[model samples]
Target: MNGAVQAGYAPPTGPDRPAPGRRWLRWLLAATVAWAVLLAVLTWVSVRDDPPTVREQRNLAEAGPVVDRAVGELLAAAGDGGAARLVPDALRRGCRITPFADGATLTRGVEVLLADDDVRGLLQRVADRLPAEWRAGVRVTGEGPVLRADAGEFVAVQGRSAGPGRVRLTADTGCRPIGAGYRAPTAGGGSEAETATELLRRFGGAEGPVQVSAAPCPDGTTARTATAVSAPSRPDRPSLPGTLSQFSDGALHVSATDELYAYRSSSTVVAERADGRVRLTVSTVCRR
Candidate 1:
């Protein structure tokens, strides 16, 4: 070894070609495990931080019974048979009361069998009494009346007569932070039918003049009916039902009784074959 060291070079005594392929494989396995751990951590964080959807927050299943109880209590307090009976019917028609950070909203389809005056009276009573019972604040603004209460913070209530008998009641009852403002989900404005439905839900009846007609039924009964239409003010523009449009193409058909009592209302979509034009129609119908 001393002679070799003193010479030009020493002979190979140990394996020094390169590290085994297994060493690189082991490093790769370790790196892969680290990457997987990082991904799992990131996924966990995302899931934990993500917020719930509006529908989830509403939790109809959990809130339905609560709302039912509240409404029942209110009805019991009112002792008004007309209002008491109608609320249950409205609830059965997929009506719901969903809570938010500031308050809760109540929505229901309306098809009342009672007189219009009675329905209006009942609604007024509800608007008047609910806030008092909940100890909520009431504020009448340009948009309409609003009710506010303290759930976790300040909650509010706002709603309207969706249609002739349909009602939409909103209350602020959420715990989360509110941004700009809260706007409840409404029907989309895609087709004439959709627009008509939304118009009825928003305003209940058409603002234009309604047409009346009568036809004899096969059962020897007279069928009295009322119809109304809303059309685009200009040919280039589209029209919506209710008082918003001028062309008078939006149309509605309802029973004469409904027209008289103002109990039931509807929205319809009509398509003209000649020009392939679509329009919305809103109508009110009376029940037998």
Candidate 2:
């Protein structure tokens, strides 16, 4: 080990080669990471949309009963008055309050959907399907069990403001006792039909043409129903007064009789006193 300056060159003490397979390992590691990221991205993209599938379509097709039951259940969630009280927003939206059709299968989009109890799609969708009269130009506001309706006149129900859409028609309809409760004179089963007949007989002074049909009761029964007798207006004919009353409780009562006819639904009642001279036409529902 001479101390003389070793400027010529230095001897290599350690191995001059790089780590064995080091580059290959790094390349393999990089490839693995890239593959992992790509897999993760692909997986995310695959699940992002999750659109309805063939199985879902088939399930929807087979889900007719399910959809029907769901709609029924949701509709049934309403109270005794009718669907209006049960689901006002839904009723206002587009939900058509109709007699539950027998044997009709419901589809999600094709028929109906229950949606969710918390979500409003059920009501929105139903509202979308309603006739123009129900949703016709009306502004609605507020919340909860009570609703309000204001158009030409201010109408409030339960406690909420009833929008213009709610004022045009009714949803909840139940049968009420009319005239003196009479025992059945005939042997036929006591029903809405019998009630309608008894009402006509008891209040027989009706001079105008009267029409009757089976009315669907709120309790899921159908009976004889009557509407105003209509005739073509003649130049000499006197215009009859139309009697209609509304109640905050969502009831309407109308009455038209030779002497007097009264009709009531929810909270409204209309009475027409004919006194045997003036022909009064009243429309209403009576319990069997």
Candidate 3:
């Protein structure tokens, strides 16, 4: 009976005993832990040293100071001859946020209403006067020669000819969610405002639309500018350039031509007459 084996046989507790999927279960557990560890490592690698996810957000208001600083520096570099005014918002309906999301972008800048016909030279002067890190350079285009540079911090600065005697410089912050709209800084008429007004009166020009612009400087100071245009006016002497030449009381003559005049004393004052309109622009550094 002992030699006649049973239909099925099994070992009780010995080396010959089956572990019953114990090894498979242990392998499965090990594989699961390894996969989890790999996932954790990948995640850590991706987000290491990254800033808190805040949309890299900058609204028009937040970006105004940056643009103003750039514009101020640009005006300073362009000498005291060109008439400059700040364009707080240049992007109109075209201000789109991004390709992957819904948002808006704001661009701010200064427009040179009066400039030398030598656009190339004017652009070159501005390019050289700016911070060397800006990598400013002039490139030729069909419309005219243009100046472009990276003003650091993702701010793109560019200068181009707008018309026969017009040039514009801009610092653009590509795109961001319109966190907040721009609120222009409150500014009063600086001391130069009176001078600008006096010059206008000397030319028999009546004050028209006036725009005041302000920007922050790198030294924790603010630069301010005031611009006024006239309505078909003429000087007592009948010659715009000649009338300006006689104003040598305290201002240093910057430039004088048939259609334009510039003087700089404590502030830069520019007068340009074209198409029966006289435009006056005044700029001062660190006024506020």
Candidate of highest TM-score? 3
Q: lDDT for each of the candidates?
A: 0.35, 0.29, 0.68
Off by over 4 Å in 2: 1-138, 141-167, 170-204, 208-210, 215-220, 228-271, 274-288
Comparison by TM-score, 1 against 3, better one: 3
- Residue range with the least summed lDDT across 10 consecutive positions in model 2: 106-115
How well is each residue in 1-288 modelled by candidate 3, as lDDT tens digits?
866757697545567754868778989999999999999998787668543243244555566566667766786776454555555455544445666656555577766655356778788888988889889999999978999987654668989987876778888767655566655566664665566677677666555646777776555655677777776765444566777767655666545775777666666667777777777777775321
Could you estimate the TM-score for every candidate?
0.26, 0.22, 0.65
Error of 1 at 265 (Å): 23
lDDT of 2 at 58: 23
Please report the candidate that would top lDDT against the real structure.
3
For each of the candidates, the C-alpha root-mean-square deviation to the true structure, in angstroms, is 16.6, 18.2, 6.8
Ranking by lDDT: 3, 1, 2
Q: Which TM-score value belongs to model 3?
A: 0.65
